[model samples]
Target chain A: MGSLQRLGRWTLGVLERLGRGHLFLLRTLLAMGTLVRRPGLLLREIYSVGVLSLLIVAVSGLFVGMVLGYQGYITLVDFGAAEALGTVVALSLVRELGPVVTALLFAGRAGSALTAEIGLMKTTEQLSSMEMMAVDPYKRVIAPRFLAGVISMPLLAAIFSAVGVAGGYFIGVGVLGVDSGAYWSQMQASVDFHEDIMNGVIKSMVFGVVAAWIAVFEGYDATPTSEGVSRATTRTVVHTALAILALDFILTGLMFGDI
Target chain B: MTTRRIEITVGIFVALGLAALFMLAVQVSNLGEYRGGDGYEVHAYFNNIGGLKVRAPVTMAGVRVGRVTAITYDAERYQARVSFTISARYDQLPTDTQASIYTAGLLGEQYIALEPGGEDEVLRDGDVILFTQSALVLEELIGRVLVNLTGN
Candidate 1:
């Protein structure tokens, strides 16, 4: 009977947290309505979140693509299908790897930072002081960061895919002696703009919304203490990574499945 | 950072992202090719299509001129009907053009090859080619060879 009571209490606690999270989301979204009037704040946040993370995203994308190209060439050469290396690389990057990897990297880079920043603000009573000064912290702080994250995601994903494709070309044609013309021509013949590229963009956008929402929510919901801030930051990263992966599977099925 | 510096940096980032997308669309995919409309379609019937897929190239004399648009069964005629669109630039094909399915290399994809005949009348929209050759079936050829060998 004691164990049953504990289980019941745990479920209710979870439900209560879920309800508060949803309310926080609603309030943040409403606060975002005034965003057009203060584009400067959003721009600053974009610089911190998106532009600052560009180097890591591009470098990682390059290595990933080069590895794919080298591996693909070796396997395909055995089958005398080396001409298909470009098609294989481009399709995989544009359809699956580009958006998914970018989202994971973004969560690690920007999502955790956003959570930590907001959590620190709370721990220091900055948010409470802003409220005392008749300032709505949601509009002033949370909304800009949230909007910045949401807007930066798709752009970063596009850059990653493009750089990755270049990296693949470098390894496939430059290092492996694959015919340059065949490399690009085959990829052009196979990859469809509307089907693959647009779907990837849509996927990144969805991941951005989810990652930003979770980060901001965890920070706002964190207990006002240093330990609480650290916990919230850790949760933000773990939850965002898991959510991006799970959502990628569901999005891929919906986008690609004939059924 | 100063507001001016942040604004410029963000602007450059956005520009870079857009340029990357442009490269993906134009260089990495066939976005430049006019896929549909602005072209006339012709029909042909085949006994066997054999791995032919939609969007497969439709070539004339080894040069691509169009794309396969649809493949369906003509139950009334007991044949496979294929419809393809020829770019407006290649609208002067003879009405008696011969259409045959050909595979690229031994294991490559299947595509339609059209050979223009000596007819003065050019093929028009909705026109059907009278001479249609079916795709070669390797298994059937092997079966025929086996039958000949055993019989001999």
Candidate 2:
């Protein structure tokens, strides 16, 4: 009886949390209706979130591409298919790794920061003070950040994929001696813009929304204490990471399963 | 001044991102290759397609000129019929050009390879190449080798 009661309580707690999350998402979306009136706020958030995340995304993308190129060269050489290194590296990065890795990094860097900033504001009574004023904090604060995330994610992913392809070219052609022309031509032949690149963009956009949502929501719901803010920041990273991965699998299956 | 700087920076960022996307679209995909009405289709029949798939490249003399558009099994003839589009730029392929299925690199994907003949006639849309070779089955070759060795 005790165990069963505990299980019931746990289930109720999960459901309550889920309900609150849904409500938060709806309110944020509704607030987005008025975003055009305050473009400056959105732009500022974009600079903070998007520009701030750029260096890490580019560095990681380059290294990841180099590794893929080297590994792909080793494997393809064994089969006398060293020329196909371009297609293998480009397809892997553009379709799967670029968007997913960028999102993961975004979650770690930007998502956690957003959560901490907002949670700190909440703990310090800044958010309540805004409420005491005539300003709607959800409209002024959360919605712009959310919009910035969604807009920035796909762009960041594109940069990552492009840099990654260049990195692959550097290692594959320069280091491994794979024919440079063949590498590019084979890649051009195999990958499709509509099928691979567009799908990856869609995935990053969805990830951006989900990660930003979790970060903002957690901060809003944090208990008014330092420990509470810290916990919310941690939760933002963990939840955003899990959500991005899970969404990637589902989106990949939906986009590429038939082919 | 600060606002202008932020706007300019963000504009540059978005521009760079869009430029990257355009490069991916043009350089990595078929969008740049097959603009509408720029290619012609021809069909070839083979006894087996092996692992041949749609969108596989069709090459002549190690240069890509087309892609396999469709693959269908003809139950009556026990053959696979492949339809492919050759770029309009390469429309001068001789009518007697022979189509053969060849594995690209060892253990790699299969593609249709064309061997041009000396005939002066050029192939047109709906034309069928008469001379063709099917995919070589590795399993069958191994089985035949095993049988020959054991029997001998």
Separate DockQ for every predicted complex? 0.87, 0.72
Model 2 chain A weakest lDDT span, ten residues long: A33-42
Q: Candidate 2: which stretches are off by over 4 Å? A: B35-38, B94-96, B116-122, B141-152
Best by lDDT: 1
- Give candidate 1's root-mean-square deviation (CA, Å): 1.7
What lDDT tens digits, residue by residue, belong to model 1 across residues B1-152?
78899999999999998998899999998787775555889999999999999889999999888889999999999999999999888988998999999999899999999999999999999999999999999999999999999999
Per-residue lDDT tens digits for candidate 1, residues A57-131, read: 999889989999999999999989999999988999998898889988998999999999999999899999999
- The residue-level lDDT of candidate 2 at A187 comes to 90
TM-score of structure candidate 2: 0.91
Report residue A104 deviation for candidate 1 (angstroms): 0.7
lDDT of 1 at A166: 95
